[model samples]
Target chain A: MNTDWKNIDAASLNNLTLGEAEKLFGLEPNFTEEELKKVRNALSRQYHPDLNPDSGNIMSKINAVYDILKNEIKNRRNAEQNNANGGATDTSSTSSDSTREEPEAENINDNAGATDNSTSENTADEPEVENLNDNAGATDNSASENTADEPEVENLNDNAGATDNSTSENAADEPEVENLNDNAGTTDNSTSENTADEPEAENLNDNAGAANNEPRNENSNITWEDVNRIGVENLTLDDARRLFNLEEDFTENDLIDAYNRLDRIYNPMNFPIGSEEAEKNRATMNSIYGVYTILRRNLINRQNVQESPTREDTTNQSTQVSMNPTNEKADNSRNDNGDENSQNIPSADNEKNDGQTDRPKDAPTHNEKPALSTGPTVGDQIASNDTTPDPEPIPVIKSIPAKIMDHRKQILIIIGIIALAIAISQAINLTLVAQMARNGNLWHLTAGVAEKAALHAKNINLTSKLIALKSSYDSLSGVWTIAGQKLLTGNLQAILRGISAGSGILGLSCLTAGLIKKKSAAYKEYKKNIRQLIRDFNDLSYDEAINQINSLRENINNSNELSDREKQLLLNQLKKAEKLNRQFEDIDQGEELEGGMSL
Target chain B: MMVDSIITLANNKNYLLLMESSILDDSYFLGVLLDDNMEPTVDYVVLKKVEKDGVVCAQQINNLNTLTQLLEEYGSEYAENYN
Candidate 1:
């Protein structure tokens, strides 16, 4: 059915549901983005203002409904994709868990085979014991024939009975061993118990393995009860390593691998939802993940300490350090053991060691003069001991001139708008002036009427002549006033037009300057050379820094690398640096400043 | 006949005849003055047939407020069609 475009108002149209919107467009529900676009285009063409003059409201409603349907379709597709991704992750975890179970099953089978062999050996010893008993009985009969043989027969019977007792004890031990193996297998196979015990066993094994310097693959002797007594919070770094099934001296990569393996096996998604196994797996996963996070944070902090540079060693290398404000803010934040850093590591177990691990444990205190107190800043390596040469700097620059030129298009558009507004204002003013000139004495009708009444009371001939003379004078005066007003308006318009033109020219010049700077080979080479010089400033002596600054000034003046404007900008920057250097000298002469300066 | 004469007069004067209605045997006409550009301007006026001396002529109703009210009533009625 077709909707009557003329009858539907915007309010009622907006309240239409998805099905109603589809009916409006003559399409089925759950249309694709492409199909919606095609239908929308057809409807747009049918009701467009150019084709149908009275269709503005209708066309707008059509577009609004089109957008609603398009967004709905897009959201549905996004939700489907997200669900697919979640399903894929669950599948991968389940597959990995199954693979892990295969090895455990093999281990259980091997244990069962050992128990069976032991049972077979006990059975073999039974027959031998029986034979010995028979032989002792025969000896006992012979001893009955002679009183001297009775003592020997008694000793033989006792020996044979002792052998039978020993064999029976061995047989009883074999069943107990088999029962223990069976219990271990049951613990591994039982979903709820295995989920709870395995992680704990692994964590304890991790600690035991570390203490014994054992390989990761060694069988765990520690029980889940021992781990429960120690508790997850009190677990040590070795426990975390064991939880990941890692050796004592594992690298970051090894830790990552172990974490991935445990994560897959213990992932709750691998189990049925809301089940006991899932809940237990979730708890175990959280424990493992928390331990892993703490260990990794400690490892990273230790690495940062070793890699940091020493300020004392670099003292002879450079006296002046260029500390940008951005770098200082970064260093202050990095060194500050505040709430923000604590929030970054969000583990309940980690909270216990917050004071110890929040900052680098090995990092020197404030009283001790550390080489480099914080992480390195971008583009400024103040105390780096790296011997390799710095790479070539990128030619990208963000100078003030370049930034202004970036808005050249917007500037041009603004100038054009201003010009158009001025022209329209001038046109309106001139139209008013022309209208005023045409109306003339019509504006002063009341005054004219009053003058005519007085003229009629006086001599008729003289009054008419005087009235004619007055009318001519009034007309001339009006013309002069209109001309003066037009002149004033014209001058104002010219001044505004001149201002607009000047701004347009300024914008164009900025655009040209930006383009020249970008394309200039000399500018590129200058930037590359200056970057290297700036990087070396932290390593140069005070006098050397001064010499370098002077040489840079001379280079700007002598070289054809930069335009006059660029040279001026560079000179201004150098002046700031020179002033800073003088301030440093004053500080050296015992004049302390409250805060430091940054470039 | 009065309506036909008013229409002819309005055409000759270049006035926009906005609305007309008949009640009993009498007809009422509403129109607005047009400027030199032929666009509507100034107040609207009511027109009716009246005999002045011996000749029948279309006379303008001079009550500007009443004419304005009538124009507003007509404007509201047709506003939905265009907008």
Candidate 2:
């Protein structure tokens, strides 16, 4: 019936996470109430998580999709029932089939809570649980056969029942999803056991039939396991060369096809992280990603190596595949897969009506799909869980409570969080204000503005605690600035006059003292010499007088030359002379005096 | 000895030594010890007056030794400059 198998191929729903989809298909999932219960019971039996073989996990993913869809339907029914009865559930007895009607393993977990041993056993019983579905399906086919103009339900698992039931095709379970989902459960654990035992038939089916139908991009089947096992054997990146009957030189498109083939099989999101299986698979997925990276790198390297004549492009060189064949590990190169890969899911009309009949009779046409996250729109809810290769939708409604409760709680929490955030923000703002005050030259700027306005404000020198101006300058800057300008312009010589005035008084006093002093002719001569010394001290260049006076002063300080009166008189005269000479000691004083400059 | 005596009195009294650098004309030497923050220290050896800074323009024992050695090395140069 899938005449347009390729055309009718619905886009895969691989992107939706199982739990998010589960929200859409809550306890009463995406499937109808009746159909959800049927699929739920069947799945609980098939994928009794703990008891299923490691390989049975592929089936578990498929069944998880189914369980989520069923739960969504159940939740919708429960919500409707709640609305009908004013929002109170009588917890009288959870055994009233409504709880069972919910698609979650919760009822089972709750039922078997007292029996821990049964958890694994319940899971182990999942494969056999489909048997009950088969019986139920038998009952439905008999009943629905007579219904006039009944819409056909697309069940995909029809053909795989060769090992189980004779009428398995008519009991097609997920027949529309056979290429993707059915084999998912098989690869993880069963590949090792099954591939080793039944390689020829299964291998041929996957390698040949699966590849062409999948297109160059749908590389979901050639799993990490396939990549790990395939080596350079029948199926390799170079496998395209054999298919097209060409040499190893293949186009980029061929490589992409091979990579896609390899990609479809590796289940990166198969299990949750930190789970034992997920951790194991993490390593495996990383290696698979690494392999793809290597293939890309190899192709690029080969292209570069061929094109570059000078080997200057040393970066493109790599050790050939055989040399590091086994060392080539899988990586998360695809784990960081971009948005383009996950962008579009299947639209409805193009879906297949493949005559997949392996599904059990009486199982609802809208079998439950794997759980995915909450979809924003109703269409998304359906689309997220629509794993069917062909969109064979059995009508579902929009009934589950919009995440209003979550939104309300979030709003309240956000209000509290924002209050706290505001307090912190305010505190930070205050600290910044304080820091800004510390940095600003508030006093200096006012002083500057004052100085700018006033004239003859005898350059006030103020050192401030606050820094304000662009240079963080204090009022002292004005003094320094005036001083520097005066210094540069040779006008600071006037201040030196104050220092020299003291010396002039002292020199005249020394002259008078020397004239009054009584002594012999030689003492009079010495007194005369002293008077001359005072005149020269006043008249001489500052350097010459300072040198002579300093020498004499040192000698007198060291010597017991005169009596106490002589010493006291000499000291007073010396103090005045030294004061006069001190102004000239400044380099600017001597220079300005000699040149008649003002600085 | 007299300066140390004055310092001892000052310690008992409420007066404070605000500035530390000592200069006579352009000839000045710094003997003050300061803390990491550059505050003057006064109490290395004293308990109550934990000197944040040191004695101003005085040769301490270590420095006296250093100065003796420096003088021995650069004594002639200094003498010439003095002359």
Candidate 3:
């Protein structure tokens, strides 16, 4: 009756069931496909934008509604085909029934069976063809305006004829088709009623708390973002419940209902086998099951807790039983006098038994026992006196020092890298010196020496002869001539030997120095002493700090293995420590003198 | 003393003072000068040589006093003690 369907937004339209949507077209929820076509034809003709150009975007809304309803019809037919083909067990088939609730799930078979009866009734729909023709003939005058819908109506007629032909083939087959379509068309109206009663029945059960958790948004169009927002692999029970749109006051029934609806919505079969949409749906499906299982387990645990009395309650009951050693005898007497005392004397024991049984078992949070106790409320006192005294919190360093401490390891690693680089470079230099020796490339040095010797001779006032010698020496190559071949060879040999010896000595010295630095006890002792001295200085114990500094200085001076450079570094540390100690001593003396006098 | 020995050797002209080049890099020469087909014909040998700016620049290494001063200049006054 509310045909202003143009006012509905896409989101609300997506949420609409086939029954609600069919009502927008002014048709009953139980309308056949042929009747649905008739309704569409009538609605479109009345609201065609070309005919009613002033209706704004009414045509778009009509088209959107048409497309969505068409999809639902297509889905229903697919589900029926699947059922006929014995593919009803297909998990995807369940997903196609997304709008159906859990209570309707049981009626799927009943509805399918009832639809057989409805389809047989649809055979009577042939008489209604004359009315459809009349409506179609009325629209012929506005042929140009109705051209878009004409072909579609013809196709519907063809489909209806095909259905009629199929109906004539076999009554048994007709029922299956009828059941699927009938359930598809009238599912909302009939199933919704069936489900309403079922939910009430479920609520009446002791696990009524679970029934309250039924998801309110039953036919939501879940998207990829929604699936991602409810993360799949790490899907929590709460997130799963939220995904199902369940409320806080939930029961096992609510969880099952929510799971079924969501499972149908996220059926992987709805999307392409391996498409992004399918993957999203699969994740959602897995998450739904995951959440369902957790909630089911929690529900079971809760029910178990409710069914079994609390540990304290059991203990108290046992004590009551022990105190009343005649409980068995009393029970036997009560049974014997069941008709007499049932109306006369209301026993306190009977009242207590009734109170315990009637006490709320819905949640563990309810402190019903404290209220039942006639004495001082010990439970309330214990709860009121609950105090968890926490330990003192550590001081959080919020300054540059904290940052530096964090990077201390990185700083040490960098320093070690630099030291390694320097050592590698030094070793490389020593290798190059050895290589120079091995190559016997001492001719350059020989030429240099000769030139210097010539220059020295010149400096001693030997003049022209010395100058001539210097010029000859400076220009000399390492090549031998006939006159001094043996002499040049001998000189080259000696130079090579001397260079090899010098390089070997230099390499040995370097290696020994590295080994000594690492293994030297004197160096180690000096480093330890210096570090201790610095600590003492920081402590502000002037006398002790001064004594440590002196001791460190003595250690460094006595250290035979430390090089001059190492000794200098230690001495610098010593000077700083001595200065700090002196300053502290002055402060100490001033404090002492002040203590001796008035404040 | 080394300068006098070099002068006497040059004056006699029995020994030829020869060098490979007027330039020295990290590579250097330090010994008695010998001609091609080298023979150590002289009675004494030089222990040091100095080259600068791609030339046979000075006779300073020929003087022991100047050599010791150079070592001290580079902060090795205790050079013999280290050796």
Best-matching candidate per lDDT: 1
Query: Residue A18 of candidate 1: its Cα lDDT?
Result: 56
B1-83 in candidate 2: lDDT tens per residue?
Answer: 11112122222221112112211111111112234543333322110122224422222221111221122222222223221
| Model 3 segments more than 4 A misplaced | A1-13, A17-19, A23-236, A307-599, B1-83
| Per-residue C-alpha lDDT of model 3 across residues A412-496, encoded as one tens digit per residue | 2222222222222122211111111111122112232333333333433343223323222212221111111222343433223
Tens digit of per-residue lDDT, candidate 1, span A1-599: 38676566543432345566678777776567667766765664466432344453455456446644554564465556767677543221123222123322221222221243332332333221111112111111111221222232223223322112222232233332223223333112222432342332322222111222222222232111112222233334433443444433456555543443333233333333345433444434444444554354334333445453333222211111111111233223323433222121112222223322233333332111234425532111211212122222222111111112233333232222222222221222211111121122121111222232223313323322232223222222221222222333444332222222223212222333322335456654654455344434434555887898899889989977678877775675566455545533443332221111000
Instruction: State which candidate, 1 or 2, has the greater lDDT.
Output: 1
TM-score, per-candidate, Cα-based: 0.18, 0.16, 0.18
lDDT order, best first, reads: 1, 3, 2
All models, DockQ values? 0.00, 0.01, 0.00
Residue pairs in clash, model 1: A206-A242, A310-A371, A311-A371
**Per-residue lDDT for A348-425 in model 2, tens only?**
110111111122322111122323232222222322232233212112111122122332222222222222222221
